[model samples]
Target: MEHTQPEQGGLRESKRRDTLQRVAQAGLELFLARGYEATTVDDISAAAGISRRTFFHYFKSKDEVLLAWQTGLVESLRQAVLQEENRQAPLDALCGALLKLAADYDSDATFAIAQLLRSNDQLRAANQVKFLQLEQAAFEALCHLWPQRRRRGRLRMVAMIGLGAFRVGIDEWTEEGGTQPFSQRIGHAFTMLRAELQVASAAAPSQ
Candidate 1:
């Protein structure tokens, strides 16, 4: 359902969301089945059981339909980071937000969406842009958690590197044909990162 989260329209009424996801699901499936360039807007509208007008109401283009699932992620992840139930360290909390997002994803569908995006140059570039937004969102969430005004630079670094680690984890997952849970891949990346840092610190020349 990557699981079909379509906050991209920014209009979160129940029916509106349902329609948006329905269209996105249809479009992504067609894109995977037929071919991104070959699939037209009309095909998606027909597949989703929506009118052409309805399709445009939710998505700007076929590409947008594939990408719409990723919109509104910035704020959602921020709120997830703020949840009271998660009492992890700052970096872990940030990653936790992302883990929560992936928790409900349909793994095969998620892999298909990733494949769809990488199948084209424009989509790949746009995908990179979305990830950049995610990094900024992570940074802001960390700032909210620790607003002492002293760790600004460090928080920014964490946000950047945290997403980097996530990218690494995702890359590894996809490379391995997505056999394992994405959260597991992400967790292992962070664990290995922390372990290496400890070893490096322990071996460092004393100041």
Candidate 2:
């Protein structure tokens, strides 16, 4: 029975993920078809073949359903950073982990959700909250990954730069309607940031 417990636990978690995915898919379909303002929780629940209570179990509100991808991305980035093994510079490691995430991103779903957030005031607010949560998580992970620089504020600065690049990459990708791959756009953004950093370093006076 003890051995079966882990298996059962995994199965339960898998079911939960499935339910959440279904709810999100249903919500997206309805939102796209009828517009975000016209779609209701009941509409999503019915479309997903689940009861309203079950819909609430998976998502707190309609806006949350749209932001669910952000939660997944944060967790993925956390795991990637934790498992990273390359002995590169701290900032390089952080940027590499972020680029890995961009490479594996779902551009279509992201573009669709971004469009919804832009059209709805409430969803945009919710997205801002999610962004803050992601920023905090990334900053803490960077500090842990490079403890020596944490106190001097260098890690914090690196985290900010990394996130800035990510945000700009996503914004540009969304602006293009996701026509180009997100990973390519993110790589370009990082390259530009690195070049600017190099120029700044070269211009700074030596002590």
Candidate 3:
């Protein structure tokens, strides 16, 4: 039988996960019942059985509670892309990571986020803004993995285009009456982008 050794970092990570879950669960329930704007930091802290100071330690603001899952998801995608084996082409790694994210978000977390954003106008706006930020972050993360020359012109263009396609994919997935899973929607968007890129690539030299 193989045995694994316990590590100090693992223990700290476990504790951090527990605290985050507790805070997020409490915050979500309060937001759902009392409305997001009406729900204060104090309310969330009380519900989580934590003090205001403690809540501040975990989350900067109530709005950030709703954004926590999204921010984490984006960071995870970036890390996955950075860590992929033999990723000589930044575009390939980015697209693959994005596809994985699409599948991941097809789970309950992204569904719940979609519901919340759709239900509330303020949250919708907030989510839109946050997604744009995430797209920029994703581009920068990918750029970091590439050499400086690749990040300068055409490679940067590819990243921008890829990120824009991802935004479109997310919008399609979250749109009202859209029955498709987020993964499928995002995949479709990527397919479309790839087709367009191929066409542009074919035409550029002839022009």
Candidate 4:
């Protein structure tokens, strides 16, 4: 039997990943503590113990660094949705996945991140782009649970609707000062969404 050779550059790749995470985390901290506009690239590099050139080697701008940090959650969110593959209702599965994601978030940190993302014009625009990427990720994950050709459209819809409710839920949770658990806020939003869907279904004409 032939044995696969050990992976190349394993330690170097890991060190690179660690350095990137450190820089991104540091950038987020400064953005939260000093406001996004006030935090400089040097501030993040100093916090992460890297030079400005090293920072640029990892990221183009501070905004990109922060968004890159936020993007880390996307893979986790995708995995959460995939874990719901055994559930019967696609909509319920999507909401359950969302709630799973919500439960994992630190409420205070989540609220702070929300505020940070919405604090400035550039971040706000980037946040919107991030939402679109999330929606696409959700749709692709849902397709794994229901691969039927006819179900594709509905699965796509579920992804869009689920994320929409989730976004609104987070906005409301932050607006309320994060007193409520993020899971409960998201649950309520999904409930209201289900009610609205039921009404729309009932009002539609029979085929």
Candidate 5:
């Protein structure tokens, strides 16, 4: 006799993933087509062919659906930093992870999502909140990459600088309409950061 238990579990998990993707796609389509404020949760549910209750099972709110990709990226970055095999310097690891993330976002669908956020004040504010959350999560994750004593005061500074570079790189990429690859833009941003640091160090008085 075939064991139905494992099959059932796999099928359930697959259905959940499908539901999540459908909700996200529906939300993005509505937000892009009708404007973020004009579109409601009901619209997304209807477009996704699911009940409002079913939509709520996947997302608490419309904004959550819109920002879901960023949420997942933040968690992935945290996990990447925490992994044992990522032995690069803290800033290097952060930059590498963020560059890969930017590359993932380099698509027409993602550009449309960005445009939606840029055009909507409420969505932009909500996205800022998510960015702050991502920053805090990243700092904590980076701290875990070193011993407690080693992270007492240093990891915070490194995290701040790393995040600054990431934001700058993303802004530059978006502003340029993604004409250049995001990885190259991030590399240039980091290179400029390194030069500024070097200049500052050279000008400082030797202790």
Candidate 6:
């Protein structure tokens, strides 16, 4: 018999990824060309050279196509955060992961896709939900980084602070190329939040 087992498995996985890619590309192109609201699932399926049933196998709906990349991003970010060396602080680890993800979107393909997402209301709503999911994933990863969540003095506060800083950094990076890099902005945001928190703590009246 031919040695078809491993090769067959690899081919199957590659074909699945290719199907998803084609569906995503078709959806994005239609969204950009005819506008997001006007583009239907049928339109994308036809463009991708697949039937509607096959399209559903790759993505649930057209909204999913715009938010597709996010499926793998949370896991990628988690890996990046966990693999940092001893020199990296918690904030540094978080920023490094977030910045790397931002850099992934700096390409021409991603730029056009971003513009489409910015202009489309349906895509915007879906994108917002996907972002919330990512934030929760980040929180879970941070909790894993420092076990004993209940014993930690400010676990939730610290998690929220890191995520907020990363959000601001992303907005700044997208709006302008800026003098500084995205990673630097992420660090600066965290530093500013820490300073403001310290000031507020000091200003509180003691009982």
Residue runs of model 2 more than 4 Å from their true location after superposition: 1-17, 149-152
Model 3 TM-score on a 0 to 1 scale: 0.72
State the local distance difference test value for candidate 4: 0.87
For residues 1-207, what per-residue lDDT tens digits would candidate 6 score against the true structure?
A: 367998999999999998899888788878878977788999999999999999888887887898775668878777766665535456556666676766664455554565566676776787777667667666666667766768344545555677787767656655664445545666667678778978999999999
Residues 70-100, candidate 5: write the lDDT tens digits.
7577787687667634467777777776767
* Most accurate candidate by TM-score: 4
Best by lDDT: 4
| Per-residue alpha-carbon lDDT of candidate 2 for residues 1-207, written as tens digits (9 for 90 to 100) | 777999999999999999899898888888878989999999999999999999988888998876765667777777767666536765687778888888887567667777788786787787777666666667777667666653538766777788888888877878888888888888888888899999999999999
RMSD of each candidate relative to the true structure: 6.8, 2.9, 5.3, 2.8, 3.1, 3.5
Candidate 6 differs from the real structure by a C-alpha RMSD in angstroms, to one decimal, of 3.5
Q: Which residue runs of candidate 6 sit more than 4 Å off their true CA positions?
A: 1-9, 85-89, 108-111, 118-121, 151-153, 171-192, 205-207
Order of the predicted models by lDDT, top scorer first: 4, 1, 2, 5, 3, 6
- Candidate 2 overall Cα lDDT vs. reference? 0.79
Error of 2 at 70 (Å): 3.1
Per-residue error (Å), model 6, residue 95: 2.5
Per-candidate TM equals 0.81, 0.83, 0.72, 0.90, 0.80, 0.75
Which residue runs does candidate 1 get wrong by more than 4 Å? 1-18, 49-54, 84-88
Better of 1 and 6 by TM-score: 1
RMSD of 5: 3.1
Candidate 5, which ten residues in sequence have the lowest lDDT sum?
79-88
Compare candidates 2 and 3 on TM-score and give the better one.
2
Candidate 1 yields a Cα-based lDDT of: 0.81
